[model samples]
Target chain A: MISKINLAFSQCKKENRPALLTYTVAGDNTKKKSLEILNAIAPYVDILEIGIPHNTPVADGGQIQTSAYRAIKNGIKVKDIFKIVKQFKKNNLNKPVILMGYYNTIFQLGERSFLKHCKRSDVDGLIVVDLPWPENKNFANKCKKQSINFIQLLSPTTSDIRMKNIIKDSHDMVYYISMLSTTGGRLKVSAKEILKNYNKIKKINPKQNVVIGFGITEKTISSLTKADGLVVGSALCKTISGALSRGTNPVRTAENMVKKLRSKII
Target chain B: MLKLKKGVLLIDQHDKNYMYGGKFGGNFIPETLKKPIEDLTNLFGRLRYDKNFIKERDYYFKNYVGAPTPFIKLENLTKHLGGAQVYAKVVSKANGGAHKIYNAVVHALICKRAGKKYIVGDTGAGYAGKMLSMAAKKFGLKCKIFMGAKDIKRQKPNCDAMRKNGAEIVPVYSGSQTLVDAVSECMRYWVSNCDTTHMAVGSTVGPNIFIKICAWSTAQISRELIVQLKEEFGGVPKKLKLINCVGGGSSAAGFWNEFIDYNKSQVELIGVEAGGPKNSKLHAAPLTFGSKIGILHGAAQYVIQDKDGQIGETSSISAGLDYPGISPLHCFLKDTKRARYTSASDEEALQAYKLVSKLEDLSPSLEPSHAFAEAIKIAPKLSKDTIICVNSCGDAKKDRAIITKRLGFFR
Candidate 1:
């Protein structure tokens, strides 16, 4: 059977527009609005990456950390993120959903059990930022058995030999972290740096679908449209947070940001 | 050509990662207040060894707090035990006797330097709170102390000292209505109104900055011992070990810093916990039984957290000794096998209290009474000449009535 991920990427390549990836922290500020945000953004975006908040997220910057703290203080448990996903499915938002977070949260929730829960929730993929490629093989195999895609992140730091190994071991598309710093750090590094890393990774595995993420915004999406998919985070999450602070509709704010984001890809 | 001071690790003042521990001790407060916490920690770390801090501390140590708090040589107890020649470093002679003064004085001074007019503190010992209030009064800072209503009834005189120092006693009645509750209340107030307000924590529980201060002040015991024994008894003991009961772990950390690199083969260290025939899971024995590597109050340590990720159960004979967890540095020490930890029950500890009062004319904090209980059991196993040291961390004046009420008068 042609896998769903391959099918999605095949459709992405043919469509010529970069896949619109929208990211939101589940239960940030408020839980009810978080669920609303999921359903609201699903139709506008090609994919949704839901953040599972943790107490100590090692590799996040201030904005996302603040969001994570709010989510945690709201009594949002790791299991509750799955509940929100289930609620989104009940609303018939068929957009592919991925759970993205640090490795500790997944390690704390045993790999086998977490994959099973993801499968039960119809969570299409997993993107643990800190888990490197070959070390994730056991978890990747579990996801494969469950037909869940385990995504790997590649950055400017990836060497040619490492890139080859990572692309070979990865079950899904390689998520290319666009910069060296954390998710919301000022993007002082050029898109050329990421495109340079992208070309190197493509040289190793040309057929592997690669998605660009971290600090993806409308202003920078044009430089990264060559990638099979574009994953938006930080900037989009920050936009929704800004709107929520001003008492604007979070769903509408997310939808508007996605529209602006998708326009850049086209 | 110069013989360098050994065992000292030096770092440049400007190194980015120059904190005592990695991110654990780095000042990560908001930028607006970063300078203050950094200044406070740096100033305190410097003052710990500063001649003035020592000179002023010595005065309190002598006449006011009763310094040279005797190192009573437990000759009969040691001979009976046949283990080590145990000596107690008594700190109970101070106006409000306890090693809590060591840190409390520094905390109050930090408040004074920051141009804060009032000092607020939360305490499990009530001694640290009382000491902070007393220090604040002496230093001309108005102070308020938050204590658990349950603790207030248990430790009445310490509560009175808060009022005597013109400190407003805010009784916390939150979950468990104990020291932990009082701390939570105090923290909530501090975070909301971070003005010219300084909050003094009772023990070396929150941050390593507090540990450095407590260790500095209480290290005087080790310094005095080395001098006294060298001058009066010919030379240092062949092997010297320091034992202090671990509550929030200040006394133990203070005592241990002096002998951090003392040849373990020669000298040994022991930390006693409050123990009874209870499930280790439910007991307040962080070193003996805790399995968590989570943050409590502030720093990461072994805490008795329940399955639902809540701070779990704690138990002790004395209100001062009652805490769910201990200092993270002590946790690190315990894990590295640098120090050994054990516990003694109420029955054994009470007996030790009586034995010490009669034999040595010393009344120790109930917390160390637990340590004495353990000493009684193990003393018979050591050589007659092996020296063991114990820190009587505080005064036992408030404990007599509790003893009378519970077990009748000291037989």
Candidate 2:
């Protein structure tokens, strides 16, 4: 079966525009609010990434970390994430949904059981931030066996040799971290610098879809849309958190933000 | 001169291969830390086996840190036990008052060579921090130690000692307010300051490269024990049992590294964990009781956690042993059945602490008191010909206040 992720990338290629990928922590603020927000923005985004709130997201900056803390405070559990993914898939089958988080959550849930839940819930892909390539080959193979796309991550510090080794495995897409800093930090590298590294990776495996993430916001999305996709995580999460703190309806706010971001991609 | 292996130096390969099996070890750092950890891993892999580095380390060990510490027979305790012939490797005789100075000096040397002016680390009982601070002072490097807020209260003297040695202490107030939380805080701090700082990991925990470096540096303890045993027993003991307390498992790794490759049937390696209280919902014995495998401090290991996979709280009278996780090396050893892991309750440890003091006129830190408690339990059942050697890795002077309070003498 062709994965939903591959189909989304193909759709973006046909449209001649970079895929607009947006992320939010599942069960953030409240379960009802989080699901409503995701459902509201599902149509505008080419792909949707839902973070499985973990207590220790060491790779994330202050923004995503706080979002996760709030989600957990509202009593979000792994079962709740699976339920949200199932509901999202049912509501929007055209848009692919990927579960992104640390490996400890999966390890805690048992690898086979977690993958089984992912498959049953129609989770299209997985982006484990901490489980890097080759070190997580076993888990990736399990995901592949279950027909779930295990997205690979390539950072600026990844060596050319290591990149070749990493891309040898099949993946639906590769996430290229734009800078060495965490998710919410300011981008120190210019678009030209990111494009240079992105071109190097494209040279190694031109067929693999590449998405630029980390420090991407609405203001910076126009410059980064030259890649196959752009991931706006911390920026979107910060928006939802900021709106909720002010007693505003975050669902409508996030929907408008996604529409604005998607409009800029053209 | 140590002969260099004649070939292209294999670089950046062991991060995946350094664990017990190729399946265990690898760098799982955040993207922000990839470059620095890679560089440190490469430098450590090269320097740990380099003959010149070894010579420099040995010179520092002999002249500066006073290594090759005496392995005493413990004749009085052995006779009192009336079963196994007992021995203790007196690591307390080393400078900085414990065996931690060995790894501290080696890591400080690495930092100096790499042109890093500052070293950062997390400590449980403050012994490792004090030792590192002393080494940093000697090597002209600034030091910062992140300690748990709870541990600071228990180990006040050692905290004072670390500060006296010119180290800045950062109190951690995260999960459990203990060593596990301190480790998490330290990792976060290192991620931001990795450019000008080197992490002096206090134990054989964290990432694979750090574990390998600590174990290699500390293997000097087992090496000296081997030579001492050879002279005392006319050869290595026929039936040798090695024991040490396990926190993040530095002492056990150091004590058992040399003998792991020996005949499995003839050697027995034991790791003792802190069993805080019997029925009070407090204990740090993850290996003995924990059934879950989780990631903490960048390494995959057995962790004391709840059903939801949240890391649970841990406690021990000895701050060093009060951790929620064990080193991946210990987990591997336990899984492979190469070592036995047991626990001693706070009551048992307290009794053992007083017994060792009364029997041998030597006061042992509560960390090693766990091992001594286990040794006292098993030694009586063994035959007289069998020999058991325990690594007395710390002194008891730092635990005076806590011990006195626990004994009801402070009121």
Runs with alpha carbons beyond 4 Å of true place in candidate 2: A1-3, A6-18, A69-75, A108-110, A168-170, A189-192, A203-207, A217-225, A238-266, B1-23, B29-38, B75-82, B189-197, B261-267, B383-386, B409-411
Model 2: chain B TM-score relative to the native chain B: 0.94
Q: For residues B364-397, what per-residue lDDT tens digits would candidate 2 score against the true structure?
A: 8999999999989988899998899989999988
- Quick one: best lDDT, which candidate? 2
Q: Where in model 1 is the C-alpha error above 4 Å?
A: A1-266, B1-6, B9-36, B45-63, B79-83, B276-281
Q: lDDT of all predictions, in order shown? A: 0.69, 0.84
Q: B1-411 in candidate 1: lDDT tens per residue? A: 211123642111112422333322222221122233445677776766678866777776665555565667877666566677878777666467887776677666667657788778888758878888888887888787888888888888787777888888889755556776676566544533345577777766654454455555566566666666676558766776677788777777766665666666666778887674344434556777655654455445666654323455566667776777776656656665667888776666778887877677677868888778777777767776777777887777667667777667753
In the range A1-266, model 2's lDDT, one tens digit per residue, is 77788899899999999999998999998888899999999889989999988765667777887788788878988998999888877889778999998888887889999999998998989998878766678899999988899998888878788888888875879999887677787877899999999999989989899999988888888997779999999999999988988989899999999999999997
Interface RMSD of each: 11.8, 2.4
Query: How does candidate 2 score on lDDT?
Result: 0.84
